[model samples]
Target: MKLPVWKEGLAYPQPSEMSYPGGMTRILAHDGRRDLLPFLHDCTITSHEGRLYLGWYNSTDAEICGSSLIRGRYSEDGGESWSEVFNVVGEIGSAEEHFVPASFFVHEGKLYSLITEMGGKNLSISLDLFQAPETSLDEWERVSVLSGGFLSNSSPIPMDTGDYIAGVWMPLKGDTPAFPAVLISQGADIAKPWRCSFLYDPLAPDAVKIRCPEITLIVQGSAVTAYVRNDEGKHGDLTCGPSFVFTSEDYGESWSKPARMTAMPVGNSKMFAGILSDGRRYLIYNNDQGYFKRGLLCMALSEPGEVEYTKVYKLFEDKAAELDNRVGVWFYPCACEQEGILYIACTLQEPDGVRSAVIARIPVDTI
Candidate 1:
């Protein structure tokens, strides 16, 4: 499908007020500078019961001057009238170096967000889990921290038992390629002996592997599918990118043989995905290998087997080429599909220089 030149809507509203060296600043930090740190990447927009639910990172120093983590945002009038950014995974201290926000969803009358805390090596104990509040968009609070590990880009799939199945990658000690790990848990007890298992173990006696996985649960159909990349070193830096998939039938029990997705190979990282209300699946990713830059965002649809699938289509691509150097490249795509309308949100290098969030609304048929 031919991609559309992003039909820009009202840009995400800037924080009403901020504190700075001179005085209080009321500007959207879209310019790259020491004063602001871009943090609105990896965004998801879900329209439920007439309201829009947005979740993304809130770079700590975006305004006052520090590093921020992922947070939640909401819009009452479609994409207009955005509420002030609220914490989805709570706030981090200045001493904390690696706290990043990712993954968002609405299940069982609550907003679920997964935020990862990376502390380099010593901080190997990364935290990735779900945060739900009464009304998180307005008054965000960390209801619970699901699981912690070296998890960065992950996708949470809800199961029939009110629990969750998530796709994760925990780096194994040394230079071993990050292994794809699966976690099954209920509520917020990640420490309860995770119904966990490592899907793709490169060093294992088994030759097959699944890397960088993104999973979706077809609750009604009782099926689960995971998309992953086969980064088996042999691909080298060229094939070191992403384009792999794995599927599961028995909840989180076992996975089928992985099928290579040739559709999303230009150069991308994390694969953020979602399932439409009608049961169609959507996968959002970026071509971030830097060859064409991270300007392209692609969406693909498919069933369980991976053989029969919709032709990969570029849903949204970064047109802000001139501002690439200042704001960096476009990446971190999070998506939400409801009632046939698919919402794709991502971060981009604004012409002013700072990194800000931009969104695109597309019909599922367009994919």
Candidate 2:
């Protein structure tokens, strides 16, 4: 297949020091001192019943200690403003456990939040459900803890057969590294049985090892495609590498061998793959040249079942020099589209090790 070339002659958005086009780059939450709330990352944004909901994980520091908890905020007016942050999971003295927000979406007229927990002898995934018509932050109920080794921050896509396919990854039992997998829901009831299908196993002798596989699924007709993150860089610089792609013809039951994507350079960070309201396939990722240099985040356009990207747009970039020279400026992007506008949520690390969660709004029609 021929790789798509970057679209030229189109007027791109003017760069700004503090904001992006439409002045939509605004900080939703931040920790200045790194003492009160140390780390804030893995942000996911979604619209539910006309309200914008932002969910992320926070801890005393950047570590996955017992002090980690899931936090959420709601925006009533299209993300122009937001409510005070609140704990979606975990408590003040819950030092022995960790609860991280994995995914949030509405399915079957019900709002659902997936929280992954890690504690002593316990590593499980749980579901929280709220009635769509009359749901509030206080109304969420822990429904069930999904069995098997399924964990991801990407939301599941509803299949034509009425089931949902969630992209997940698990650590290998022995010396092998982790790889991507699919969690097949039984039906509309998310609390029911879920079967697991391993897509790419790096431990196999013939398999291509993919580290930290943050798999995002995109459904096109009867086929489901995955863009797996190749976290490990080939040059040991943790920088430029092609993302691995896989497809499943029989729903999420089976998948094809992984292949390197063309015309796209993905960093060792997470990337998002989703369809726009206009039926165009888009991917948001860090198109940096070196490892941990997530300052350049770009969006590209592609067609269904196509490995090559046709057009590219610069969404945001942080040019400020890193104070410590060890940390990147941007990473962990999560996005969703509504009414032709794309809302992207990501974490911005400051020079002094402080991290803040920010969201950017881009008019999809302009791209």
Please give, for residues 1-367, the per-residue lDDT of candidate 1 as tens digits.
1111111231211112211112111112222243244545556556656666776665554422255555656766545456666655545565355455566656656656566665543244555445455543443454454565645454466677666777666654565655666777754444343456555556866645434333333333345656553444443244454456666667757766555554445344556666666555556666434433455666555543332344355544444323342334556666666555566666665556566665556665544
Model 1 per-residue lDDT at 333: 67
Model 1 alpha-carbon drift over 4 Å, by segment: 1-35, 47-49, 60-66, 89-93, 121-145, 150-155, 187-194, 205-220, 230-242, 263-266, 287-292, 302-307, 320-328, 350-353, 365-367
Which candidate tops TM-score?
A: 2
lDDT of each: 0.52, 0.68
- Name the weakest run of 10 consecutive residues (lDDT summed) in model 2: 11-20
TM-score of decoy 2: 0.84
> TM-scores of all models?
0.71, 0.84
